[model samples]
Structure formats: C-alpha cells, structure tokens
Target: MLKTAFAPMALLAFVAALPAAARDVLVRDQAGFAAAAASLEPGDTIVLADGEWRDFAIKLVGEGTATSPITLTAQHPGKVILTGRSSLAVGGTHLVVSNLVFRNGFASGDEVIATRVGKRWSENLRLTGIMIDSFSNPDRRFEDHWVALYGRNIRVDHSHFEGKANAGAMLVVVREGKMPLDNRVTLDHNYFGHRPVLGSNGGETIRIGTSTESMSDSHSIVEDNVFERCDGEVEIVSVKSGGNVIRRNLFLASQGSVVLRHGNGNLVERNVFLGQGLPHTGGVRVINERQIVRDNYMEGLGGVDFTSAITVMNGVPNSPINRYLPVRGAVIERNTIIDAARITLGAGASDERSQAPQSTRFADNLIVNRDGKSPFRAEASLAGIAFVGNVASADPKVEGVVVERREVKLERAANGLLYPVGATAGAPRDLQPIAREATGVAWYPKPAGTRVAFGSGATVEVATGPALAAAVANARDGDVIQLRPAQYLLAEPLVVRRTLTLRGHSATLRFSAPTLFQLEDGASLQLRDLKLSGSAAPRQPGNAVIRASAKPMLVNYTVDIEDCAFAEMAGAPGFDVIATVPATLAETIRIVDTRIADVSGAVLAGHSEKGKEGFYNAERVVFDGLDMARVATIADLFRGGTDESTYGPQFTMTDSSIADSGAVLLSGVQETTITGNRFVRSGGIRVTHSVGSPHTEIAHNSFTATPAPVIEELHYTGPARALLADNRVSQ
Candidate 1:
C-alpha cells in the first residue's frame, strides 16, 4: 500500500500529478508480486507469470496519471489461470488490468472482482480481454457478483463471461451511499453465453444499477455485446439506472429481454434479436419513464408477459423504486419486428398494477408475425397511448393498432436473417448488422460446445447389457430403442446424451442403480407405455430415478412421459420420481395419460432451495390426463420462501385423478391452473406466492368427502384468482 504522509487530498494530487518513468516488473507468484506492489509508481507494468495461479487474493492500489496508467497483465495472454476461489480488487486511479482468466471456481466472498476496496474508490479504470468461464459456486444459493464497478469512468470491454450457474448478475456498475453519485461506465464488446434458467431475479447478465439507485444516473454504455443462449431470466440486460445507452447488442437465441426496469432517460436502439423461433425468446421490455426504443430488429421470438418484444407494462400507483413504477413518456418507434410472438402494451395488468402506461408513442414500426399470434396485444387501457404509422403483416385485426394489413414478403438473407423483399412499409432506415466475430476476446472462443449433428437412425430393439447400451450408443437424434417385453434390469445408469425415445410397450425397467436414465446437456427423453420401478433397496443420489445434467446446459432438457406407470419406487430422503440436478433445468416436462403409484417421495421434486429468488429445475411442467395415487405428493413444485422471484414454473394440470396422496398445487409460479381433476382422500391443493400476475385458477374439479376444498387455508394472499367455482363436493 502507498503510504500518504501529506494531507489526503493533497497527497492524492501529488501522487497523481507525478508521471514516473515506465518500467516492466516480472513476478512469478503472489509473494513475488507483493514484494513489488508497495513501491508501484505511474507507468509501471506488472507482468504475472503464466500457468495456474490458484486462489490468489490480488489487490492493486495506487494512483497513476491518466496519460501513464499502471497496468497488471499476464506474461502470456490466455495462459494465466486464476482457479479455486480467487479474487481481484483494484482501488486507485487510472489503472489497466487485462488478460487473466477465471475458471473452475468462484470468488472467496460476495464478489469475484471489485473495483473498490471498502471506502477507497477507483476512477478511470479499464479492464479488457478477461475471461470468466464456467466460474461458479457449488452452492447455487450462494450469490456472488463476478464484477462490481464503482466510482467514475470505468470501462470493461472485450471480455467473456459465461456459465454463471449460481445466483447474481455477471456485471454490475454499483451505486452506493445514501446519495449516490454519477458513475460513467462502459461495458462493450463482451460475450455473455449460455446462462441457464436461474428461475429468479438474480440472473441478469449486466445490471447497470440497483433499485435504491434507480433514480440516480450511471451514464453507462453497454453496446456491441453478443449474448448467446442466455436464458437466465426475463431480463437479460436489466437497466436499473438513468442516462444509459444500450445499443447494437446481438442477442442470439436467448430467452430474455432488455428491460428498462427503473430510472429514466435511457436509450435502447439498434439491437438485434435473432431467436430462430425458440420459445420464451424476447425482444425488449419497457418500464418507468423517458425510455426510447428504436431502430431494433427482432425475429423468431416466442415469449409472453414481461418477455414480450416491446412490453409497456402496467404499473403500481405511487410505487416505490423497487416496485413497478408507472410508465411515463415512453417512445417506441422505427423498428422492424418480424415473427415475434407478441408485442405487449400494458402487459401484466393486475389488481396490483392498476395504473396503465401514460403518454406512450408507438410509431413508424413494421411488424410481421407468422406464429398465429397477433402482432400487437393490449392488456391494459390504451387511453394515453398514441399509435401511428405502424404496419402489420399478420393478424392486423388487433385493436388499438389501426395500421395497414398487407402482404410483406420476406427473404432469408445471406446472414440467416429475414429481410423485407423490398418495401417502404415504415421499417428501420438501415439494417445495422453486427458482425458475429466482433465481440469478446480473440483467444476465448464461444463457451457453447461443438454443435453435434446427429444422423438419422433406424429403431433398434434390445433387452439389456451392452446390447441395450450399444443400441442407445448407436442411436441418432430421432432414433427409438424398442425394449423387449421383459424385465430389463439395469445395473449401471444409462446416460442419454441424444434426443431419442424409449419405446417400452408393456415392458418394465427396474432401476437397481441410482439413476436408470441420466440426461446430459441438450438431451431429450420420450418414455411411453412403460412401467418404472425400483429394487428391494432403492438407490440414492437425489432419490431420483432419472436426473438431468449436473451443470448448467446451453439447450435445456425436455422430457415427455406418457402412458407410463410408476410403482414400488423408493429413494433417498429427498427424491423425485422425475428430477433434475441443481442449477440445471428441463425446459418442458410433459406427463400425459400416465399413472403413478406407491412412491415414497413426491412424484416430482422441484429441486429449488428456499430463500433464493428465481431458482427452479424446470421452466414449464404439465400434468394432464393422468392417474396418480398412493404417493407422498402428486406434484411438489414449490419455488418456496420468497416474494422476490418473478420467474414461474408455469404449472398446468387438467383432466386428471389424484387419489390417496398429497398435492402442493402451486408455489412461486407465474401462471397456474388446477382445473378438471378428481381428488380423492388427498390433502387438497394449496397455492402460494403468485409472483408477477395473480392469474391462478382452481376451477371445475370434483373432490371426495373428508377433504373439503381448501384453497385459502394454506395461503390467503391475493394470488388465487377467481373461477375457484364449479366444483362438486361430495359429503
């Protein structure tokens, strides 16, 4: 540490004003670095020796001139590794840090890297060419920020941050103190990759500021970043401060929107959302005031609610900073939106958020939607909104958007994007195409592994041993392994790594091992007409018969179970009949016309920890046309213990019969429906914590005697909506 003998301000000026002769100091280890750190002067460059430097708490603190800044870099770029609980703290003026990689670990504390240490602040710092890849904590509940920026004039560019499986944002330009000051920060040319569904609020890739400082100005610029498969939450880039410019970012196949959640005077333009018709892929969502969204292009997105392309949300009256504030003076224009699911105006209009958006202008935009949904959807009143010069190609019959409905043909360009054939239909003036090769470090490639192209295969039948394993091993993407009509006893777990089906027609698969079927990343399972059971002593490891990938995956898992029977199954203390590993999720788990009986644990375990925001193992679960009985619980889908999460499990169970079991019903889901079912001698249904909307329905069901309909006994909050009627209760 540099000792200050003179007055603090005068000493800072005296040190910052002096420019030392430039020198290069080579240090092999932390001990060697510490010996030279205390005497660091302006224009000094400290070069760390490459190769595994594990668990090093590096602190660089000193003043440097703007013209001659101090730098800390690696002897060899892309070779210096900071693994196993390492952190960096830089507290001073005019410093440049570059070319260090963080891998296979997390921070020792709440932050992996902080620009300030305690009350000491940093100014005019630049960090570039850094990579934090798959750097995660084991405990998903433990939230840690990767980068926390403080003070003024900081820039983090040409970096790659990927696979943050745990909670917390990847980068946050922090604004502290009771009266926070303006901090000018820039985050550009970064690559954010493959963030899984965190199922809660702490999953933003970049958050400029928080709610307490939402009214303050950060003056941050986040542009030219590439976010690929970043399905962390509804808000990928959560802008929570004022006077920020978010432009020219490319979101490729991601499932979240850039939301202006708070603050005012933000400009969002020229961003391209190329989703390829993936579900839950969104464009931009607008809230609060003085936000302009223009010159953006979106195509092949399928999301609703807050993930809608341009969601002008409903607001709470006189809301606080953290809550949903009223939308005022929002301008959305000059954009080309094609093949998106919906563009919502006044979305999420509930009794809680009764105030609609005010003084909004939607003008001169071209929308082409071909996914059978209307291009524009207005859930709230459009009294204060002005719609002008907008053109729609599909379903232009929607109200409040009185634009021309015409044929706007599209052609697939060389860049794989759909462009208008030739038109002046109020689209953007120019297509600002961002190059795919212009973001992130040149050394670090995309975090997503090689995309495997599986060949078409014929259906193979097998009984057991390497024959069955070989059949599965030789299977391709759409292949089916037809099981023989006999007991296929599995000794070891069969891990499925491809998209295939297990055709078990009147066949029984007995799980002697911990897991009968394990799914790695990008795996999908279709099990039909099968009987799944366990041995005399059931195996452990989540007490699950099947498990998903242990780590966060780029493409989420999808499992479809139909006409399947489960009985005589027992597992570890906390087991699910169908379960996934922590921090990993199955996008859709649809169980239809199935029967489950004699399970010791819940029929399904939602492996989310308590007291965490937006943590879930599955995105959407459907239990339709099934018969479940004699289980601990039919479906225990509970993202329990918090009102902070906005992501929902989105549960739906209709036309089913659940007997002699308990049911949790719903918890922390965005939308739920428990309709058209027969409950016999069960604990009944309970609904808790309706996150964003209160659209829960428990309607049109029949309950046997001894368990009266108890919708409000477990939770009396306003989550349970109307239509809890039309139920037949037998006395």
Candidate 2:
C-alpha cells in the first residue's frame, strides 16, 4: 500500500531531525564525553565536571524513564576524576549515578571489573557517592571493582570501594530468572576496603550469586554498611533467592562468612562480627534454605580447625535437592552468637533424612560454645527438625535433647538493660556483650563425636556385603567409611586401611572390563556416593576411575562416569607410574557428577620421581561436574611427571564442561581455585613454576571457544607465581 504510507512519512521525518530530547546534559574530555554520552535520547543527563581526565573507555546503550532518568552526574563535588588505564561500561536501563572518582584502571591476564555493566530486569538504577580505587601493582593483578551488579531495581547508595586485592568481585548481585520480578535493591551506606589484591587471588569481599539462572524472588536492602580490612566475606549462591535485609553492618578484620549455594527467605539483622586475630575465623555460613539469622553479633574470634560457626552441606556431594529439605520450610530465628571455635548446626544437609528439610525451625538462639570449648559441636535433629528455644550448653542436657541452644532474657520494656538470660531479643546492644577475653585459642569437643552416620547398629537400611564387611571391618580410631547408594561391582580393588568411611546411599558402580579401584598401602579412604566406569578397559583402563597409593591421603572423592571410559588397558596405561608423592597433601579429589563420553589417559594421578610425590601431592584435585563428549589426546591435566622432581599440580574447578581437551597443566602447582568454570573448545591454561611451586589462582571463570585466554610461563620453570584474576574471556 505504497509502503505503508511512506512508512509514517519516514518516521515523521526522522522524528523532526531528533536531538531535542534533553533532561540535563554536560560532559568534558574524551571526545566530548563520548559524543555527549553517545548522543543521549532517553530522558538524558550526563553532567560530568571536576577535571583530571585521562584514557577513559565507556560502553553504554540506551534506556530511561521511571520519572525521566538517564543521569551520569559528577559536577559539584570534586567534580570528576575518571582516571586512566581503560574500561568503563554503563549498561542499558534507567541509569543514574552521582559523585565520581573511578581511578586508574588496568587489567593484566584475563582482565576483570573493567566496567562490564549489569544485566537482568533493567530497572531504576542509581550508584550514589562513588569512588573505586586501585593503583600499586606487583603483578599481583590490581582489582578495580566499583560495580558489577547484574541488574534488578539497583541502588548502591553512599558508595566507596577501595582496591588492590585481585580476588576481585567487590559488590556483585546476580539474578536473571525465575520471577518475583527481581524486586527493590539497595546497598545503603556502603564502604568496602582493600589491600591484598592478589595473594593467590584472594577470596571475595562481597560475591552475592553464582548463577545458573532460575529461582529469583530477589530483594536486597543492606543498611548502614562498613567493612574495612575486608578479607573475603563471600556469599556464593547457585540458585533460589528471597528477600534479603542485612541491617546495621560493620565487619572489620574479616576472613569469615561464606554461605555457598541455594538460599531462601533471608534476613541477617543487626550485624557486627569483628575479628582481628585470624586463623580461619567464621561467623555466618549456611549452605541452603529459608534463613532468617536474627540479631547477629559474633565478637573477638578463635580460629577454627575443622569448619562451621554455621554450615549446612550439599553444594554437591549427592545433591539430594541440594542436600535435603524444604527445611521445616526454613527459619533460624533470633541469633546472638559469640566466640565459636566451631558451632555446626543441622549439618549433613540439615540432618539427613536423605537430605530432608521441610520445616526447619530453631527459635531464639544464643550459641556461646566458646566456654564449652567448641572444637566443633552443635548438631540439630529433632527427627525432621524443629527446636524452639536454643542455647546449646551453658547446661540442661540429658533428656533425648534433639537440637537445642537456648538462652533468653530480654527486659527492654523501654530501656531496662539486662539482655541475656536466654534473650529472645528486642534489642539490648542486640545482646552482643561477651568480649571479656578470647583472641584465639579454643578447641574442645572430641568425645570422638562429629557424628558422620551412614550405616551401623541393627543393619542400617542397606550397605551390602555384610554391611560392606562390617563398615570396613569395624573401623575405629577416627572412623568414617560410609557407603550406601547401591551398585558396586568389582572383582578386585576395594581395599581400604584404617580410618575408613566408604559411604553412599545413591551410590553406583560398575567395572565390566579391566577393573581397578585401589587406594591401597594403608588406605586412608573416604569415598562418597560414587559411580565408576569401564568401556573395554582391559585395554582402556590407565586412569579408568582411580588408583591411589601413598598413605596420608584424605580424599573426599566424587566420581560419576556412566557408560565408562577413563583410560588404560589395551595399549597399556590404565593408571601407571607413581612412587612417592606427597609434598603438601591434604586431599579433596573430585571428578564430579558425570555423563562423560570417550576419554583416554587423562583423569588424574601421576608422579614417579619428578615431584617426588605421586598424585603430585594431591592436596586438591577436581575434574569437575562433567558432560563431556570428547577429551582426546592427553598432556598435563592429569600429569606431574617429566621428572626433575620439585612439586607441581594442585587443582580445583566448579561446573566443568571441557571439550577437545589438552592443556590445563600446572607446571608445578601450588594453590588453584578456578571457580564457576565453563571453558569450551578447550586446550588453554598453562601455569609454570616447579621446585616448590609458588602460587596460582584463577577466578569466576568463563572462557568461550577457548584457544588461549591465559597461558603464563611458556618456559620459565620456577618462581613464576601465576594468578589470572576474574576471567570472562570471549571467543
């Protein structure tokens, strides 16, 4: 019809030659502020003033509303200081910003926080009072994180995040699915400190989510914050979210708090966990489920030896709906803990009923196990779980006591002081008062109890073969050999010595061909629900599944390989060569939830003399959650040989999916923690340094169509100290 009437008169003559859509605009330097904020259109606002401009880079799109927004303010306040080095991106949406100071930025191996703007539900954005620092470099990779918020009604009020510690990822919030419409976001009165930017790619100060999408709910409101000397206060979640509100914050001298994976209704009220004397300190940690840790307060500190000030397992160990439960449906009311050498509660994924949690409720808590010398005590289990007033042991035991830790005394009927007698809390200094002395030393709770139940007493469900030969022939003296998920089919190789625990409930095993699953030579075994392989492995069984030697091995194993194919048999190579091996071993071998296809001579475990210790002193090994279709030729991924000894090869990775593999060699390993992994078209990642390797750490990992993203030390054999921080390499 005449091209729709001249296409609406050519869009009204291109909207009358555009350009009159203003709302406050101004910018200086750098191509006139990137051509006036890229020719703003959406309710514009670009006012930037205050001098000192350099090599700035920005990447923004369009969008604005919610009351005519689209700002980029600066002007009145020290004006502006977008220093050099490069990178800055402000994604689409109702963008708004205030007071600026985004200093000298630069990225070495696999650049991070180079202003890679946010995502998800584009909403009213605001980042007030900004300042993101980072200068000094020793090749430790300087971190420059100001914002990494992945969208959602954003608002980062009163901000300031100093830098230099490359375990980068300052303030990150992720959520891109599962409705609830993302909800109001706010990080009120902020300030996060910095210093050690790369001492092995430090831990997170505020990591937020891990992402696999789905499960939203979303709602955050962190009030009055201040976390100086911030040394890794993580929050690694995979999915599931809820309204979170952490009030009155102040976490000085941190090195604690890790709530990895899965979450629900949240509220960590009135926070304050100051710890100076570090040694593995902790205050809050809960793996999964509906949470509401009320009235928080954990003073001083006391270095833990095992784990948990708070913990709930199963990020993956047999992930029974993420380790059991709807969890009472979830709730851990009124909290006021102190000291805590180790105060684990409802572990084994909230007290295993096969990982059941459907209505977990633990009222008015006040755990002060410090006096009782909590080396690690506190295990809840009122059957399914539900305990009203908790106060662990200031004393009241002896009556089938399920899970209790009670102490309440709140006389604040309008300022009456006295808040501890079992304080149900109404706020009396939030009942934090306890610091009289405790700057370290504390460890009691070794009645030989940490309850790792799997099978025992009157034939526990099923473990087969006379309860797996009486749980490894009456294992004692630190016992732990639990296995029960079924399917074990070996003709040989099932030898374990001393301190055993071969547990399994959903376990599956098969070895039709060249079988061999040894951990002999005084085996210090600890295997969990497993699944082995074998596809003509009488000739394809060199690294079929496992074959360990050495003694001090403490493996928290996880292997799953369906149709079978790990390596070594016909061409001879199914697990070979290994003499000593043990330079700095602590063990945590994991191949992970699998569905792997064709594989040969490259699963793990190597060492003859080079490195002196077999399994290259496996302090940590992880092949990672798999679904590979191919992993042909083999090099260093499972190697540590080439002699000349001196140590190398420590590994760790999450959510793996390596294709046509090869390179992943740690030319002498020492500290490696590659996170949220996803490397396609592999064959890249080589770090060198032997003769007692130094350090190597890579983070957040995400490399698509990889050919090369990071390959440090092409030759240099020692003193390289590699650390490629916060990666996200594109094709």
TM-score of each: 0.83, 0.31
* Cand. 1 Cα-lDDT: 0.79
The number of the candidate with the highest lDDT is 1
What would the TM-score be for candidate 2 when compared with the true structure? 0.31
Per-residue accuracy of model 2 over 469-581 as CA lDDT, tens digit each: 54555565336554565665555455544435444555655544343444543344444555445532455434444555444232222222222223222244433311223
Deviation from native of the Cα of residue 620 in model 2, angstroms = 7.8
Which 10-residue window in model 1 sums to the lowest lDDT? 448-457
Q: Show how many residue pairs clash in every candidate, following the order shown.
A: 2, 70
Best by TM-score: 1
User: In model 2, how large is the Cα lDDT of residue 592?
Assistant: 58
Task: List the global CA lDDT of all models.
Answer: 0.79, 0.49
lDDT value, residue 197 of candidate 1? 76
Badly placed stretches (over 4 Å) of model 1 are 1-20, 178-180, 371-373, 394-399, 412-427, 448-530, 538-564, 570-576, 579-595, 607-614, 624-632, 641-645, 652-664, 673-689, 694-731
